[model samples]
Target chain A: MTEEIIIAGFGGQGVLSMGKILAYSGIMQDQEVSWMPSYGPEMRGGTANVTVILSDERISSPYLKIVDTAIILNQQSMDKFEESVKPGGVLIYDPNGITAHPTRTDIKIYQIEGTKLASEMGNKKIFNMIILGGYLKVKPVVKLENVIEGLKKSISERYHNLIPLNVEAITMGMNNIVPYKIEKHVFQN
Target chain B: MSELKLMKGNEALAEAAIRAGVDGYFGYPITPQTEIIEYLMTERPELRTGMVVLQAESEIAAINMVYGAASTGKKAMTSSSSPGISLKLEGISYLAGAELPAVIVNVVRGGPGLGTIQPSQADYFQSVKGGGHGDYKLYVLAPASVQEMADFVEDAFDIAFKYLAPVLILSDGLIGQMMEKVILKPQKPRMTNEELIEKNGSWATTGKKGRERNIITSLDLQSEKMEARVHRLMKKYEQMEKEDLRFEKINCDDAEYLIVAYGSSARISQKAVELARAKGIKLGLLRPITLFPFPKQALFELADQVKGILSVELNAGQMVEDVRLSVEFKVPVEHFGRTGGIIHTPEEILEALEQKIIKNGSIRHHKTRKSSIL
Candidate 1:
């Protein structure tokens, strides 16, 4: 199976890192993967995004015009990538800080309060892990054990102690995802 | 030991150089490729293999330092973007004239002069047509993947040392920055001093004590002697064309239309070929692994099979001239590209092929594109 995806959000919210984790997980499973980031000034403070492709076969182009899924975290990303998701594909996003919600009927939409949940968990750094968890709940493209293994490989040994905490956030995100029902007022938290 | 790791192109090349037992690396930092030097600094290849990594004061200094290291038949390399590469052209010419084997990497950016920090293939003419001020040719290798980025290091050095020529890895910001899974090979120890003297003793500046001091100079006061030196260099390049030329063909058995590209453009055109095949179009892709060699013979043969050809590059149609020349205008040849750092998409490339080659219904015809922004 092949999954082409784009992860977009603010620069410091770990958008590129999330894509990197997915790439590492794919490689651990003996699959081909590529992670192409928006380099230069856009990566400093502007909206940062990465296009990641994982496939059973050799991948041809790292630059992509279409994707199977778009994990959007911010409103600007929601505006930008909502149309990039293919028909019958998935678009997952956090409802927090979003002014206008995704209204596409052709693609699957799911929401998780990643920012709020991270705040409630007393560590905002796990926000991306929660989003990754939510994406895994919908697609389950990568095994959780491999994701954890990939996480260990991505971060340094100093953060090994926090693996279990990040696992908790992931599990929380996986269990808390709700399919969008077109209800606008239900997710203002 | 071998390792399977995910790395950017620049990072993989640096690690591969260390694993290849490179003697020294001298380079100035530039965007999309600073990671080459940065990774070298952070990984501390010096500790593991005694390889020296230094940040030179400028691009010119870095190249001169590379020239010095190469004079002793040591494996030395330097990397930079476009404008910085321009600064090293004089030294590159010297390396060619003196017949030194050193690796020079240009992770090309959009440019006439510092045009953009993004990936571009605009340097095709400069790379293959001798960017330096001379009649010498560099063995230019264009890597399309991070794996090739890692793998071509040894190949470049081998080719360089074999012919006593300079080898250039003509990469772009795209490959330099993108991350992919690459299988790194096992480390090989560097050639010992005795081995170097034995292999390159006749030409290399080994020492003055043993034999009549081997004079190394590109300049000969006698015009006839200079002519002989140039002819000798020319024969080596011709040998490279006969022995080391490389290219790849994809889905060409029944192809009626062909796309010729290299580097990042090759990867993108591969995708476009697949997309067109899905729609029942018989399109194939020809990727030149070596830019300097040009793959002219392969293109000449393919020209007979395919009805038309499209040359897709990242610049304003530079390789198009070479493509037309290779085919001798036997079939229609067109160019589709986006300049100033904007990568042309597969859809646009396919559209160009249809409009310029197939739909136009001519063996050779020209029509100026009405819209340039698509």
Candidate 2:
């Protein structure tokens, strides 16, 4: 099985790092994976996105036209990626900066209060981890144990002390994500 | 077995260079490839392996430093992106003319000028056809994966020393920036002065101790002498063409159409091949690993079997020329590409194949082929 996902948001929101950690987790699980980022000037304070693919077999292209999941963290990302997600795939987003919510009926949509939860936990940097937690709770592509091990590898030794707090944020996100229901009658009409 | 670690292609290349016993590295920082030097500096290979790492003031200075170190028969390398590599062309020409063994890496980006910082295969003509002035050739290797990026450094050095010519690791920004698992090789010890003398005693200037002084220069003013030297260089290149051409052929046994690409383009074409096959189109992919000693024979043989060929690239149409030349009109060959750093997707390539090549039904004509060949 292969899971091709795009995680996009503002530059400082740890979008790239979150994908990196997930890719590392895939490696720890003895799976083939690839992490490709949209580099250059777009990564500087603008919208940044990464394509992360985890597969049981070798990954063909690191770039994809359509993905299994779209983890949108901002309104621009939502507007850009809503149509790119495969039908029946998942779209996870943080309701913080998004005014225009995803209105697609063919796919499942879920929202996590990532920014609010992170701010409430006294650390805004854990926002990405919270979203990641919500993703894992919905898909369960990788185990939580491997995610912690991945965190240990991606985070430096000096920042190891913050692992517990990040884990707490993830747990809270996994429990708090709410399903985004679209009225079927309106779409059918 | 070496342990597998997830690393960016640039970082893997840096680590592999150290483990491959590179005696020195001199490079100027360039985007997409800057991580190579950054990782080397952070690792501080000098402390562990006695290797020297220096950031030159400019790309010109960097390639010249590589030339200097290589003159002493040391394993040396320099890396930069397309624009920065343009600055080192003069030094590259000098190294090729002098027959010095060195590794030069170009993590290419879009360009005819200082184009976008996005990935591109536009350097194919420049790298494989010799960017610098002179009738010279550098063995060019295009790596598609982070693993190959790490593995090819050692291979490039080995081939460079064996042929006494410069070897280029021609990669692009996508491969340089992507992260994947790599199995690093065991560290090899740097050669001592005595070992260097023993290996390159005839050509290298190793202190000239109790022997005739060895001189290295590419400036033979005598017309006949220079012609003779050019013949010798051409002979070496011919040998490489015969013996060192490397490529991979996927799903070609019963394939009706062939897609040719290298480096990142090849990776994407592989997906296109699969997509076409799923649609029952009987498509396959042929990836040339060595761009210079280009697997021309393999392509020619495949062309005989396949109904048509499509050359997909990240440039306007560079490698397509080589593909056309290799097929020699035995089959219809078409080109599909995206320029200015925009990478084409598999779906796009597949669409192009269906619209341009497959549906066209082999528009066989000798007139255009004759004109192109001439």
Candidate 3:
């Protein structure tokens, strides 16, 4: 299956990190994957986004205009990507930050309180994992176990203590998700 | 035998150059490409190979140093960004005129001037179309990843020596900065003065012996000899075009549309292929591993099969000209790119393909076929 995902938010919102974690997990599962980030001046306070493509065949490009799924962590990201998601694509957003709702009825969306849930778990940094966890629950693209392994390998030696909380946040986020179906739009040939 | 380790494109190139037995590295500091000299400095690979590593005062001086080292029959290399490379063009043209063997790595950044320190493939025309003056061509290798970045060094050096011409490794900041697993080969030194003399001691300037005084010069006072020299260079270039054309093709046999791109742009175009496939469009990618010996024949062969061609690049439309030249206005050649350090996303490329290739499929068949002759 072709899974084109974009993880976007402010610089410190862990958008790029979440994209990397997912890409790393895809690599571990032996899936052809590519992780490309938005660079140049746009990377400063601007929205940082990464397009992660995981497929069974070789990935040619890591860029995407219309993503199959988008994980938006802030209002800016939601506003930026609302029109770009495919007609039947899924959007997972942080309800506390993403104030704008999508206009399309065919698309599936999950409004997650990732920051609040991670804060309740006693850490603000685990918010990305919480979002990732919500993403995992719906897509089930990569195994949760593989993602955990990928996270352990990615974290630095100085921040190894944060691993447990992040994993806990992921499990918490996954458990809180409610499944919904996306209507498939048919295009006439 | 060697082991694979994670390496950035710039670092891998440095390591590979050392293994290929480069005589010296003369370069100035530039973003993205800085890691190349840094790798040589940190790893001290030069010390192991008895190679000289000099961080020059400027890109101009570094290229001049390359010219000098190459003149001595030493395998020298230099690297810089787009602006920095622009500074070195005069020196590069001189090296080309002198028929010297050197490797110049342009870790491209956006430009015309002091552009941002971000990855870009905008120097396509400057690289392939004689960046400086005079009718000359430098063998250019466009690598798409860290692996090819390393692998191309040996081939680049070999081609340079074989043709007695300068070679360029055209990569962008992403290839320089991004990390990936790479395999390191054992060091293989280029032919020595003694070896060269033994092979063709009569021609090289290993201090002329009891024989006639030896002079190595690109200039000849006699116009007839100068014209002959030009013809010889042209003959060499033609031979190179025939022998050294390298490219990577995806499912082009059944492809309705083809994406023609090189280096980092090619990698991004690969993603566009899948996006198109999912949308039920039969697309393929033609990635050029060698930029200069433009694979005219390959694209010409596919002209009848593929409906249209998408020339994806980091610049506005540098390689687009070459694509047009190859196809000869046969297929509808459209361009999709980002400039001034703005990298084109896969989605943008997909949109362009949708508009130009998929929607305009009929246009490809309606257009007159370009000539196959080179």
The root-mean-square deviation over C-alpha atoms between each candidate and the true structure, in angstroms, is 4.0, 2.5, 5.9
Model 3 per-residue lDDT at B32: 70
lDDT (Cα atoms) of all candidates against the true structure: 0.91, 0.92, 0.82
Docking class of 3: acceptable
Q: Please give me the DockQ of candidate 1 compared with the native complex.
A: 0.79
Candidate that scores best on lDDT: 2
Identify the leading candidate in terms of DockQ.
2
What ranking emerges by lDDT with the best candidate at the front? 2, 1, 3
Q: Which segments of model 2 are wrong by more than 4 Å?
A: A183-189, B363-374
TM-score of the candidate numbered 1? 0.96
lDDT of 1 by residue, B216-304 (tens): 66678798988888999999999999999999999988899999989899988988998999999999999999987889998999998
lDDT of 3 by residue, B283-357 (tens): 999988888899999998888788789999988888988898898877888888888777787778889988877
Q: Where does model 3 exceed 4 Å of error?
A: A42-46, A95-98, A101-105, A111-134, A143-189, B1-15, B18-23, B32-54, B115-120, B173-225, B255-258, B271-284, B304-310, B328-374
TM-score-sorted candidate list, best first: 2, 1, 3
Q: Each candidate's DockQ score against the native complex?
A: 0.79, 0.86, 0.33
lDDT of 3 by residue, A91-148 (tens): 8887775445555676888877888887788877788899998999889999977897
Off by over 4 Å in 1: A183-189, B363-374
User: Which residue pairs show backbone clashes in model 1?
Assistant: none
